[model samples]
Target: MTLLESIKEPQDLRTLSPPEVGELAAEIRTFLVRAVTRTGGHLGPNLGVVELTIALHRVFDSPVDHILWDTGHQSYVHKLLTGRQDFSGLRGKGGLSGYPSRAESAHDVIENSHASTVLGWADGLAKADEVLGRRRHLVAVIGDGALTGGMAWEALNNIAAAGNRPLIIVVNDNERSYAPTIGGLAEHLATLRTTDGYERFLTWGKGVLQQTPVIGQPLYGSLHGAKKGFKDTFAPQGMFEDLGLKYLGPVDGHDTAAVESALHRAKRFHGPVLVHCITEKGRGCLPALADDADRFHTVGRMNPLTCEPLVVPAAASWTSVFGDEMAEIGAERPDVVAITAAMLQPVGLTRFAEEFPDRIWDVGIAEQHAAVSAAGLATGGLHPVVAVYATFLNRAFDQVLMDVALHGCGVTFVLDRAGVTGVDGPSHNGVWDMSVLQVVPGLRIAAPRDADRLREELREAVDVDDAPTVIRFPKEPVGEPIPAVGTIGGMDVLHRAPDPDVLLVAVGALAPLCLQTADLLAGAGIRCTVVDPRWVKPLDEQLPVLAAQHGLVAVVEDNSRAGGVGWAVGQALRDAGVDVPLRSFGVPERFLAHAGRGDVLAEIGLTPVEIAGRVSAVLERRAAAGERIRPKENGA
Candidate 1:
């Protein structure tokens, strides 16, 4: 068996010699490339962290000494070392999670895959350890890209002040998160990387000072106490030192021995310490290493040998539709600017950035800053489009409400992956945006049904000069255009049966599903009229009136059923005293597990068959109740 196969748990790693450990790293990389190619996960990041993860497991005993991964995309090696090596179903329904999961192992902590959160978790864990009088260490492995987040700095400030806490902050300097990390922190890290003055001083000072007999011990002690000041004069990693934390290395992250050595020193220190390790993203794989574009950070299922996608390409996705339109919008309005939270390519802003380089801004992983800055940009006489994943937008909600919505700034929030982003698991799903944003008064939300509407509504969203507007779409490829047979107010009527008994309200990409559902109902001799309310937030005034005509109204959306379009429509109908029986269909409140989007939808009863059956059952119940209530003509 190979060294990798021999390591069933972290403890198994201890049995291996130094040479075997190095061999283990090589084997793990090869295994990851082969396994991940089949399932398609965060390949480049995992490739970069093989040695780092091995060193971490070797240095710290997990479940006892907490080893937390920031962002968690780089935790595949960590998973392997912790005896969770099965990668056949990675990111799939019954498979291993792409990020750390407490359910998977006792070693995994903090399942939230959002960036820059590990430091805060580390600080809290360290505080608990100190309070409990435990000697167990807290090590947070955070990427340099994560350091760009403001929360990382906030945690650093708190960690620094707690000088008695033994915490090891491992900065995995890969120089990229999605795209090259932006902002001042990235620049500071770049500056710190170039200077080897600290390492050189430690090596030279130890040898020369030890040579002097009796004075050597005392002099070295004095110099060690004054090491921060001496190091500040040379390496200038004083950023951490100034904050009352010990700064260790610019260690080569790919070198298992070097990383372990740095980790060892940090673990020995009494107080908080920061170890900066430099590693190339996509270290082992030639294709990944050669990739200049975000280092192939996240990949789809691909050929193991060539890295070419196995699946046939579909039509333009919702993101691509937005990107193409944003470029045209940029050309028409020079004042239109775009902002991304360090995900230019993923969110489809790459084309816009290429077309109008000066108009685009990548604000690192700071969603809060992106919203607030967009508000600032709007006030400065420019229309700002803040493009981000719907899940990530949750971070900026307060900013969007306080800075943009309250102040009445014209900022368009283009939310890609707005609903049921299946494979990434619960944390990555964008289903909660509609429910959460319900409280933001005056914030208009548009859920486009097709690529045509996505383009049209995006223009409308940006045109609003006073309030914040949101345009949200799903992760799936843009479906064939569902044409409106008629329009009532802002709602597009997609299907209408003569003598309609049911009014079907379709939200966003669920239009096709609603159309299919209407067909099923019609096949059963139940007349159904389907309408797509392109804008979901503000219930179209005509909706209540239209609902009154039908015996029952069913609202379908990809968002949560709690406070989504269905709830809004029901409330509107109630206030208008329409008294129509209403049924809401959407994702349940519980967190959905990793699965295919179609499977999840079917499981949640969002399928046309399920929806039709439910509607038929409801109608049958209503008809039976009607017969019991009404006096039969000659029944006496």
Candidate 2:
């Protein structure tokens, strides 16, 4: 068996000699490229942390001693070190998750994919350890890109204050989060960040002291204490030291011996210590290193040799549709600008940024700052479009509501990946945007069914110069445009039977599924009509009137059923005094597991067959109840 295969647990790493550790690191990188390329995952980040992970396992005892990986993508290497060698089904149904999972192993403390959260988790775990009088060590591995977030600093502040806590914070400074890190971490930390001086000094001291007599040990300890003056010369590690946590090194992350030495020093410290290790993303992988660093950060299934995608997307993505239109809008309207939370390329703002460099702001991974800054831009007479992932927007809900909506700032929030994104698991899914944003007064929401509607609705959202407007779309490819045979208010009527028994209200990407459900209902002797309500919030006045025309109403959405657009439609019908029986079809209130989009949707019973059957059952129940149906019976 190979060196990597021999490492079934963290303890197995201690068995490797110095040369064997180097061999194992190479084997792990080679295995990652082949396995991850076939399955598709965070390739670049994992490649960068090979030696760092091997060193971490050898230094710390995980599960007993808590070790947390920030932004969970970094945990893949940690996963490999801890007995999960199967990469055949990574991020697929009944397979391993892309991020860390509590269910997957005892070592995975933080499961959420959201960046900059590991530090907070570590802080809480450390506090618990101190309170319980346990002497377990807590190690939180955070990226430099994640440091740009406010939460990281907040946790750091708390961690720094606890000088008695035994914690090791390993900052894997690959100098990236998604893209090259923005803001001012490297400038102030210039001297210490890129050098091996500290590590070299430690190595020299250890070698000489162990070879010498009893006096050599005292001499080394005195030299170590006095070495603080040398580090203070240029504030090399002054940034972390000023925070009260003991700072260790800017060690070469690729050098297993150097990283292990630094980690060993940190492990010995009684108080909190921050070990800064410098590494490169996509290290040792030529194809991955040559590719755009961000693209390689998270890849779909692709050829490992040429770094080419295995299956080319037939249609444009929802993000690209928004990006293309934004470029045009930027050219037409000089007042139009954009903002993204460290996701310029992923959110499709690359074209907009290139075209209007002066008009866009690449705010570092701080979603709250992005929202508030957009509000400030709107207040200054510029129509700012805050583009971010749907799940990330949850961080800026307060700012969107208070700073934008309440203040009547014409800020448009373009939420990409706005529905069930199944592969990355529960934390990565963008299924809660519509539900949470529903409560914001004066805010309007639009869920486009196709690229045409996305373009149309994007323009509409930007034109709203009073209240905040949100236009959300899914991560899936933009499929063929479903043309409207008729228009009722701002809604698109896709299908209509001669005498409709049920009015199927489709929200956003679920439009096609609603049409299929209508067809299934028609075959079952139940005539159905399907409509895509372009603007789900402050819904069209004609919606209640149209609902009154049908015997039953069912709203379908890709979001949670409790408070999604479905719930909004139900409230609208109630306000209009239309007493039609209604059933809302959507994702039930629960965290979906890692799987394909189709599998998760089917699991939640959001398919056409399941929806049609439920509607038929509801109709039969209503018929059985006859005129004896009790008043105020909520079909939902």
Candidate 3:
């Protein structure tokens, strides 16, 4: 068996020789390229961390050590080393998850896929251990890009002042988070990155001085004590050391021996410590290294040798449509500026950035800062558009409300992956945006059904210059534009059945699903009308009026059932004194498991079959009374 297959647990790595560790790292990289390419998972991040992970496992005993991975995308190697080598179905049904899973192993802690949270987790774990009088080691492995987040600094401030709290923070400095690290933190880390020469000098000094007997030992001790002076002269990692935590490294992350030695030193320290390691992302893979864009950060199923995609999307993605339209918008409106939380390309702002270089801001991974800064830009006389993933925007809700909405700043938030993003698991899903943002007073929200509505509503969102506006769309491809049959007081009538008993309210990407649901309900002898309310919040004034004509009204959205569009529409009906029997269909109030989008929808009863059956059952129950609730003849 190869070195990789010979071990089933992290303990197996402890006994490996230097040559063996090198061989194992090579084997892990080869295995990763082969396995991850077959199943389409994070290729570059895992490739970058093979040696680092091996060194971590070897230098510290896991499970007992409480080693944590920030963002967790680079934990695939950790999984393999911890005995989860079966990667055949990664990110698929009943398969290994893309990130760390607590259910999968005792070795994994903190299943967070969001960036810059590992330090906080480590701090908490260290405090708990101290309170309980336990002697467990806590190691938080964070990416260099993640350090840009304010939360990380907050945790660092606490971790630094914890006085004798034994915590080790490993900054996995490969210098990229989907894109190159941004902001002042990236610049600071770059300065520290040039201090590799200091480490080399110290290594040479320790070897030469320690050989001179008693005086040599004293001299070496004196030299090591003056290490901070050397660091200050060579670099300014004093930012970390001044915070009160011991700082080590500028170690080569690819050099397993160097990393293990640094980790061993960190383990011996009495207080919290930081070890900075320099590594290359996509280290072993030629194609991954050659490709500058994200270093193949996340890859689809592909041929490992040729690096060719096995499957290609048949249509343009919603992200690309938004990107293209934003370029046109930028050209037309010179005052319109764009902002994203370090995800320039992912959130469909690439074209806007390329077209208007000075007008775009990559605000690192700080969404809260992005919102507040957008507010500032708006107050300064320019219309700012903040584009981010719907899930990530949750972090900046307070800023959006207090800074933007309260001050009447005209900042538009474009949320990509706005609903039920499947396969990446619960943390990545964008289902909570509608429910959470429902409480943001005066913040108008638009849910576009297709490419046409997306472009139209996006323009409309940017036009509002007095209050915060949001445009949310899903991760799926742009289908053929669904033209409205007619318009009813700001809502689009997709299908209208004569003398309808039920009105189906479609939101955003679920418009097509509502149309299909209408077809099924017709077969069941239930006449229906389907309408798409493009703007969900401050819903069309005619919605309650229309509800008064139907025996039953159902609001369907690809968001959480709790506090979602259904709840908003129900409140509208109640206030209008319509008293219509309302049914709300959406994602259940639970964290959905990873699966295909269609599969998850079916599981959550969002499909046409499920809705029709439930609606039919409700109608049958009311029919037993020889009447539908508050029935209106001819929908009047």
Candidate 4:
């Protein structure tokens, strides 16, 4: 059997010889490339860490010595070695997650599929171990790119202050972050890789000292003892050392045995040690390595015939629509510039970046910085449209509230993936955008139900130079437009019947489901009207008047039930004293696992049948209270 097949756990790795372990690293890389190609996952990052992962597993007794992956995207090989080798249905509705999942393995401590924040977790875990008097090692494998985030620095500061805390930090320098990582850290890593001073010193000193007579062994031991200082002088490993942590290597991360030896030595150190391992992103894959862009960071299912991503018959997503419209608007308006938080392609800003290369900025994986920076850009008299994933925007809440909203910056925040990102898990769900943004005083929020409205409203958002505007949409593509819809104060009435008994207030992508529910209610002897409220915030003045016309109103949204649009609508009706009974329906406050968007929606009672049932119950109660009711006869 192959060495990979033999490794069921970390203990299995301890059994293999150095050369055998090297062979196993190659085998693991082969398996990862094949499996990820088929599964269409974070290929480049995982491929880059194959040897580093193998060496880590070989050196540490995991579960005892907890090894946390900073951004869990690079844990595929770690997963494979930990007995989840089967790639069947990987990243499917019920399969393995694209990132490290705590449900999948005990080895995975953090569930962040997103970038950065691992250093903080390592610091916290290490402190806990010390406080509890536990002897287990805490090792965090972080990327050089992750160092860009402010949170990572905060954690590094604490880890440094602890001074001799049993923490081993592995800086996996892959030379890329979605795009070759920006800023000072990337440059420093590049310098470390090119110099190769540490490696040369080790080799030259070993040869020279051994040839010397009498006290040569003693002299070499003394030299090796002060290796940290030597490395500090020759190579400016001063970054880690200045932070009060030991620094080792710009080691060849591709060599499993070399990495294993380095890891074993670092494990013996009491203080925090950063072992810099240099490896290529998309190491084994030629196509990904050569690509100038994201290098297949995430991909969809491939066409069997063409080997390209499988294309389907669907309307353009709200993100792409916004990008296209933004580029067009930007060309006309010189003041309009675009910014992304290391998610240009993911948020469909690639076209914008390509068209206006100088006008667009990609601030690496730092959401808070992105928001604050956009505020500065706005203050400088530029209309900056900050495009970020809805979930990721939560990271910049402080900046959004304090810098942008408080200052009334004219920056437009385009929140792509605003609701129900299916497979990326709870961390990625944009469900909280409506709930979270409600707290921002001057922030104007708009949700688009279809592609055309997304384009139009995005332009409108950019034109509004008075206050900041946030345009949000789901992960799925925009469905067919409701041609009969009418708009007023950001709300769109999709269908309205004269003398309607129930008013179906729909938000964003829930418009289609509400339409279906309206149809089902009509067949069951009820004439229902459906309205797509495009702007969920600043509850339209027409909404309370519309509620007065109906005896029952059911608000359907794809956000959390707690502070979602549905709740806001009900509250607005209550404040207006419309006297109409209101029922709000939306996703409950909980973390849902990997599932298809439709299945997840259904599970949360956002289906047509469930919505219709809710509307019927509200009407029944209203009738019992002597309120006027619509005809019980069939309306269809």
TM-score for each predicted model, relative to the true structure:
0.96, 0.94, 0.96, 0.93
RMSD of each: 3.0, 4.0, 2.2, 3.2
> Which candidate would rank higher by TM-score, 1 or 2?
1
Show model 3 residue runs off by greater than 4 Å.
202-227
Candidate 2 wrongly placed segments (more than 4 Å): 189-191, 195-235, 293-295, 627-636
Enumerate residue pairs that collide in model 3: none
- Please write out the lDDT profile of model 3 over residues 348-405, one tens digit for every residue: 8877887799999998889999999999999999999999999999999999989999
Across 379-469, the per-residue lDDT of candidate 4 in tens digits comes to: 9999999999898899989999999999989989998888887777788888898899998897888888788878877888888776789
Off by over 4 Å in 4: 201-234, 303-307, 311-313, 488-490, 621-627, 630-636
Please write out the lDDT profile of model 1 over residues 1-636, one tens digit for every residue: 777877888988877788888888899989988999998899999999888898898888987888999999889999999898789999988899999998899998889799999999999988887778888888999999998889999999999988978999999998999888778878888878887766687778889998989999789889889877876776678877889989888898988899989999998999999999998999988999788888879998999899999986578888889999999999999989999998999999988999899999999999999999999999999999999999999998899999999999999999999889888889998998998898898999999999999999999998998999999999998979999999999899999877788899999999999999999999998888899988888878999988877888999999999998889999999999988888999999999998888878988999999999999999899788763311122131
**What total of clashing residue pairs does each candidate reach?**
0, 0, 0, 0
- At residue 155, give the lDDT of candidate 1: 96
Q: What is candidate 2's CA lDDT for residue 30?
A: 88
How much is the lDDT of residue 527 in candidate 2? 83
Candidate 1 C-alpha error for residue 530, in Å: 0.6
Error (Å) of candidate 2 at residue 394 is: 0.8
Query: Which candidate ranks first by TM-score, i.e. highest?
Result: 3
Query: Can you write out model 2's per-residue Cα lDDT over 1-636, one digit (the tens) per residue?
Result: 898888889999998899999999999888998999899989999999999999998998888988888888877889999999999999999999999999999988778689888889988998988889998878999988898889999999999998989889998887777887887764544556645566576679878986789888888877778776757764468668889999877778999999999999998889989988888999988876777647389999989777789989999999999999999999999999999988899999999999999999977889999989998998899999999999999998898888888899999999998889999999988989989999999999999999999999999999998999999999999999999999998789999887677899999889999999988988989888899989999899999988988888899999988899889988999999988878998888999999999999999999999999999898888878774232232231
RMSD of 3: 2.2
- Could you tell me the lDDT of residue 382 within candidate 3? 93
In model 2, what is the error at residue 270, expressed in angstroms? Answer: 1.0
